[model samples]
Target chain A: MKKVLFLFVVLFGSCAKLDNNLYNNDNKIKEYKLDDYTGEQDFILDDSYHIPPGLVTLLTLPSQADGESSSTEIKAIYIGDVSKINSDTVLLYCHGNKDHMDFYWQRAKLLAHVNGKNKYGVLMMDYRGYGLSKGKPGEKGMYADVSACMQWLKNNGLNNNRLIIYGFSMGTASACELSANAAPMLPDKIILEAPFASVAVMIQDASQLNMPADYFTDLKIDNAEEIKKCDQPLLWLHGKSDNFLNYKTHGQAVYKNYHGRYKESILIEGADHGQVPSQMGFENYLKLIGSFIRKP
Target chain B: MRLIRFICIFLFLIFICFCSPTQLVKPLQKGQRAAAITYGGPLIKFAGAPIPIPFTTLGFSYGLTSKITGYASLHTTSLIFGNLQTTVGGLFSLYEQENKFGLTVSPAIQTAYNIRNKTGFRIWPTLDLNAYYHPLQKPSFVYIGANSWFELSSLRAHNEPQANHIIPNIHAGYMLVKTKWQHQFEIKYLGLGIPNLPGVVDYIGISHKGALGIYYSLIRKF
Candidate 1:
């Protein structure tokens, strides 16, 4: 009996030690320093154009896992008037897998401009291991990162009815997970641009073979199951000409499986993955978004 | 002498309680097993951008339980597409009896050598812990457990010496076969910290590991 108890203690102690080591080895917090900087800058509007803008104040909000002693930091960018953001409306943007939030400064500025007059404060966050955020990027870590950001918004007086989540490609999974689990306080609407059904299914479609998606089971986000549970408004945008993620399989599956209050699927004929709005004319896309937001 | 005998008897009783014959009967009686192989290519980053390198993997696994019996395939990546690379591993389980449930755990560990080339090796060690429930005529079960893995290579392209990371996983799979051989699917969440690097790259951490696969196995009675 004593030996058995000793074995149990040893197992439990070893697990705790391993957890500590993982925390100690992570150096996310020591990376980049965030500050409020306002300066004239050169911005790239697209592949072929550069736009100059007046001085803009960039505030970097740091994020960390709950109850951790280490300094792993995640970065969130708050642009425009912080006071304009309230419990009625806010735009929370999640960028794609590559690059940091700094790279998307131009996009963030554009989003804020579109919102106009600080009517909707735009909050863009970096996933762990992306940009200046600390810690490794994994399924659990990403979920935690998203949850932490949501909590931060809530602490600052934001709620479901006032929140709108926008995700691009890989970020779509995180958005879906957050939306499904948001529950009693779900977001008002969710937008997935060029979304894939699930990492596993995406792989299967990409390979075009009979191989199973078990290898990706480790990275699986199960968005199909998640989307079914989301009862809020859902907007799925996919370009018909997209080659990276098959439109018929990924985006269509999501649109088909969404059992929500108001679900809509928009197929941009000549638009590619990231070029939908620009290719089809930004005016139309913006109109669609504006109308959705203004809908009573 | 009397004291030693008493101690021995006490240990024997405890062992019997935890590892009773009833716990080992059902799944072993059923003959159930299977294996599969899967391949995952290089993970694509930006659209229209060049993929650093693509990979191909093959895997095999088996399992047996009271309600379901099956095995699995061990390969580099799922038969899907993504940037992450996995080593190899398998599992087996038992669930179903008039009044009992059973489980087993197995794990695999692999490494990613370079972001450009996408190469690495793995070492996996597993453990299984399960529980059983009885509701009159049948037994329904639930399980919670962990597995540990060690990455053996560096993640950098230049072959810089990298710190080894350990991932702990927890999951629950249902038993489809009898108490001996069963069919099961488990969901595990992987967590590990980031390695020390530089700049924005430093804050980029990798810690999520999850999988959905089937398991099959066969039990032998002694």
Candidate 2:
């Protein structure tokens, strides 16, 4: 009996950890405290906050059933007038790894204040295993999380014509996956910031070696492949000196491969990872983004 | 006496829970075959709590001659950046004093790759030295060993590319032989801090402290 129990322990412990090697949710707390606000709800912008004049709407969208993850709602923060959902263009923002939505609050605020004051609606959500969402993060699970949020916008009466998709770093994989295969709900325009081409290309760039695709894992997020199939208007922004993901190998490669209807790229000279927007200066960055959105 | 030795080995296992040093291989008789599984991982302290990250290995060995044994093994860890290794090696006895002391040497080749990253591969040439001592008329033995490997490729971890070329591990253990059943427990100290080229730094742990590791295995000889 003891030997049997020991074998059982060893076999049971062989299961892989979900957070291992991928999701870095060191602060996994769902109740994010932003200026004394807890949970997702209404936050009145007082005089102290530099954000545009608008009410920040916070809520959790119901999760859809996925075989790979436990069903749980995703937490999101939308900055803008809720009444403008029908008229204004909405940016579905996908953030990078580490931490949660709280870390991305400032970016959301800046994006909302972009095109004059309160001119755009920005919606950002935490992927599963991030923030208050309950589930392990995997390739399929993350895709499901973004799809649910997109559905929430659709249920609120927003469609592809008035919706734009924006992805940053690791989030670029999610955005590209959606834009490539999600035809019925395809986004009108796509913006990629410091994006990697794919996990395979990333490895080749980092290690400078040619290896098989399934040498380590089958979790292939080939944005290069996805971008080729996507025909949306695209804007690619990258820092020339990005240390984590090389601009020459990853960002530029994806931009070159993109055979979209319309495309543009801005390779900042001195910017590093996570510093493009600030390095481009707030006013000039807003101007570039405003022009892209306003173009017919 | 048995209880005291068990306690000592248990304490030593905790002390070296942060490393994955090599294990001592006991040579078997000609035509003998054996199988074993080992669980080992580095103990990383997170928010003041010691969490053990498991790396598991499964192996099988066969005696080609009375003094030579050959083996193959596969190993994996929980970290995504950590690569899975497949290793093949052979053990050769230098000198033997059946009831007193024995010395052996092993040299092996290990190939590492990741299932998720799917890009690079690292090759390691390793050498293991082991010495065993058995008191007269006793079935229990005390052993000491050291493993050295040359890192020959650039490996990625913590989202950074690190090129390390040297790694060494030291270990000690106890073993008991009971008919066809053999039990072994080991504690190891893996050398951390592989110096990189100028202007390059590699992260081995969350802090500056070295890693320790432990291993236990039950071998079924046939």
Candidate 3:
């Protein structure tokens, strides 16, 4: 018994000292400093675009895990009137995995414009390890960052009845994370743009093989599987020619498999991954989104 | 939900191991050879539900010298279309006592390929320390062992992190004695470890909980 105990200790003790890099493969997350070149004041809209005035920058919001506060604080932007947030509809726009808010400035401006030119509010934030947020980006960390932002909006009198959630590209994972699982509060509706089913499905699509789940990162943000549990109104928009994430395998899969009360999808022909809104025409895009929001 | 999916996969891998035949616990004499076929699966519990998946394997061992043996095996899931793993190993006896107990150490390397469509490959290096006790009868004996493996290769290209590298397994079982037959049933377990590298835990997001398995085997000696 003593020998067995000693052996167990030796074996388990050695594992704790093993290198950390051995387990992670192809985790190509690029963390960058916040782009100070662009600011709230710099977002001047052209005649084609509509800009909202409040455009306030949220300095830092705390991320909590298991009820303990994480050291990382997130940065975000609110592109609407703070006073109108209580009365008007608000859209929390979760952006894709890229540089930061600067990369998504146009999308936020467009979403605000989509919301009847500042009649509604648009909120956007950088997940931890993305922009000015501290700490590395974990699945839970990003979830916590988004949750903090949602909590902040709720604290400011933005309720679920007037809140819409929109996700684009990698941000779909964060959006699905909130919806498939229970949050502090649910959204009135969900909008997914060029969403992938899951990381495994995406890899399989990329590699063109029936790879198993947990094949790569175990980052099981399986939107296809998770969406079945969400019972909210959903709006899906995708380009027919999206090369990065195939519309049929990802977007259509999620939409087709969604067991929601109300759901709709729009597939624009000849539009690629990043050019859906452009190809669909801004006026038409606004009309579709506006109808979804104003629906009884 | 993510946690449930992670647990399901982790447990499935253990089920695959559970279906595999036991490695040669007793060192073979010169000119002796043993071949076996195994079948088993895991009883998995997740989200208050139980799931069992079938697994199978074919294994063989040959004695090169009085105290050394070479072994190899092929294993798959559901008889087809999930994953296929091939393993090669050598065992050298360090100590032996007739009608009593013996000790041996084995070092093995294994490579697994997914067979569904595209080929995904991973490699693991394993070391086993085993002890066998023979009270009076030679073939009807009991054994205990532990195997530790470090993942040396991944399915993804370009140094992306994979989940759980140091796989530690423990086993114990009794052998059913027969002249030309090697039959055994064993209990096995693979314990989970913490993610030591940056980006590993974030990507894998699996808790450090181990899996328990039940295994059985039948072999022919020549």
- Isolated chain B TM-score per model: 0.39, 0.73, 0.76
Ten residues in sequence with the least summed lDDT for candidate 2 chain B: B194-203
Cα deviation in Å at residue A107, candidate 3?
0.2
What tens-digit string does per-residue lDDT give for candidate 2 at B62-116? Answer: 9999899998875634222234556789999998888688999989887766534
Cα lDDT of model 2 by residue, A1-296, tens digit? 99974564455334442223445553446476644544332123344336633467777876654574446677887787777677778888998875678766666666776677678888888887787776666677778788887887887778898888899988899889999995336788898998988765554432233333344345768888789888988999998867667786678778887897999999998887777877887677778887888777
Q: Please compute DockQ, using alpha carbons, for every candidate against the native two-chain complex.
A: 0.03, 0.07, 0.03
Question: Lowest lDDT 10-mer window, candidate 3 chain A?
Answer: A17-26
Error of 3 at B12 (Å): 22
Residue runs of model 3 more than 4 Å from their true location after superposition: A1-47, A50-53, A67-71, B1-222
Per-model TM against the reference: 0.50, 0.60, 0.53
Candidate 1 CAPRI grade: incorrect
DockQ score, prediction 3: 0.03
Candidate closest to the true structure, highest DockQ: 2
Runs in model 2 lying further than 4 Å from the true structure: A1-14, A17-21, A26-49, A65-72, A133-138, A155-157, A199-220, A240-243, A246-253, A269-272, B1-71, B76-85, B90-202, B205-222
